[model samples]
Target: MRQIPLALLAPPTHRFDNFLPGANAEALAYLRGLSPGDPPVLLWGPTGSGKTHLLQALAEHWQAGGQRVAWYDADTPLPWELPAHESLLLLDDCQRFDAGQQHAAFALFVASAGQGYNIVATADVPAVDLDLREDLRTRLGWGPSFALEPLGEAEMRAVLRREADRRGLLLGDEVLGYLLTRFERNLKGLMTLLDRLDRFALASKRALTLPLLKAMLADEKIDSDPNL
Candidate 1:
């Protein structure tokens, strides 16, 4: 029998379809219907508000449609030369960009104008609050801006349930309720914890139940392993 690696059983793909838009319905619709001539989009929200997921979804959407797409994070240096034709550019964590990166980003923004290129960027705060240069900040706000709202309790629960279903885990209502009440509230953190629980369940051949979850936490405490 071939053993399946943990890497192969990693988290589900982040797509627009699985996203629970809640109050961001308009923003979701806008991104879904993006075209070549569409204005650049600025997505700002609190941390863990699904900004990165939306950017990834947009990149995937463009890539699937045979469009040239480039995805970049602020931690890395932005390339000076970008394609001049119809291209899709996605930048995440814009709040962390340094002065040099900001200059490069601004140049890219200017080069993309009226060139059939669409840029989508995400930041923890609005353009006015970003730590970038004044010109870059103004350019960031020149396009449509959407503030992604955090998922509410019911929405979070729905997301958890949907993720569990994708992994073929028949999580009981009691288990889901326990997780929501006892674990982290942020979707990303909760999803990480769920991944750990799923691995533990598979290794121990135990069904996902409240008791099993409690046991797994106890084992992590004893082992003192951060990954657990």
Candidate 2:
């Protein structure tokens, strides 16, 4: 059997179509309809709520239309001056920004004000809970803010089923139920584990079953803990 290249096993691209918007329909619509000169948007949600995915999707949409866009993450050093002509700017993990970074962000915001540029940011908590300068916090809330709700169990199962279908794998309800009950419920982690299972199934020419899953977990545990 031919071995699959690691590069070819990259995760699926984040897009608007695949995002399961539960109670965030309004937020999704607002993001999709954004135009030049629209006020900035702040999306607040807990971990695994798809905030980063939504931001990436929005960036993809803008860039696909030939618009200049810049994406900044929490770990990236904040630029003193953002590109003045960029049409869209995305700042992720805003809650992690330090005071100096917040100052730089504020400067960038002011520079883009009234220039038909749009900014979208995400935070782990609501704007009121952010520990930033009062003025900066206030500006972050200048536009409409949306709280992304976590997907429920049914929605997660649906997501898993879709992912399995996309990969041309058959995931039974029993397996999915077991996974949900025994493993992490976050889509990111679940999908990662699913990818591993898919690879194992293909390589071993074995159907995905509870026994296979158990064996895989046992192997993983031994690999991680040699003393086991």
Candidate 3:
């Protein structure tokens, strides 16, 4: 059997309550306020931003109300028929779509419009700047679009502290600063790294500090190398 890479594993579930809106409160409100007959919505942001989180939250919101949702990504096949009073069509990672995905996404958009279903899409860039087909690009730029901003350092600290509390792990400001300054600034990746570091510390019966973190990373580097 082969082991799956961390990057390939499915991310944890996302919900509205778990999201830290920060400067994206308006965007959050917009998604939550969408109606069945509303025009399509596009959310763009850099990687590790909260675009995926919000999209999943919206899907969760609709699903909780018993509405049907059709979710499509670069790899997944779209549903042929939409069923239910309110249907939500979500297209994720639009910027990375192949030709087939772009075509299918455009068709989904048309069908969603015809059926008065709500459509929401996410991309790394705004539709006007997308590299997809011209028509599809135009269609994507048609509806309300919002740009998500990365969390500020202060906001990130709050999140780290909150999560640390939940995990019963104590992280000092110095250690947290070390992580924030050295890590890739995405909350998902940071959280995963934190989880790994916590486990390493527990197994070693050592305190979690900058030195401990460095040792854990060094150990992981050696473990991942077949020649080592």
- Please report the TM-score between candidate 2 and the true structure: 0.88
Tens-place lDDT digits, model 2, residues 1-228: 535535355578898888899888899999999998899899999887889989999988888999988877667775656775857988888888888888888887898888888999999887888988888788889899999988899998998899999888889877887788877677777888888888877766788987778777886772322332
lDDT of each: 0.83, 0.84, 0.82
lDDT of 1 by residue, 1-228 (tens): 223326445657778987789988889999999989788789999877899888888888888888998876766654656875689988788898888888888888888888888889999899999888999889888889999988999999899998898888888999888777775567888788888888888877888998888888887873323332
lDDT of 3: 0.82
Clashing residue pairs in candidate 1 are none
C-alpha TM-scores of all predictions? 0.87, 0.88, 0.85
* Candidate 2 local Cα displacement, residue 190, angstroms: 1.4
Candidate 3 local lDDT, 1-228, one digit each (tens):
223224333445688888899989999999888888898899999976799899999999999998888888877864334445558888899998888888888877776666778889999999999999998998889999999998988888888787777667799988898778777678877787888877777777778888888888897872322332
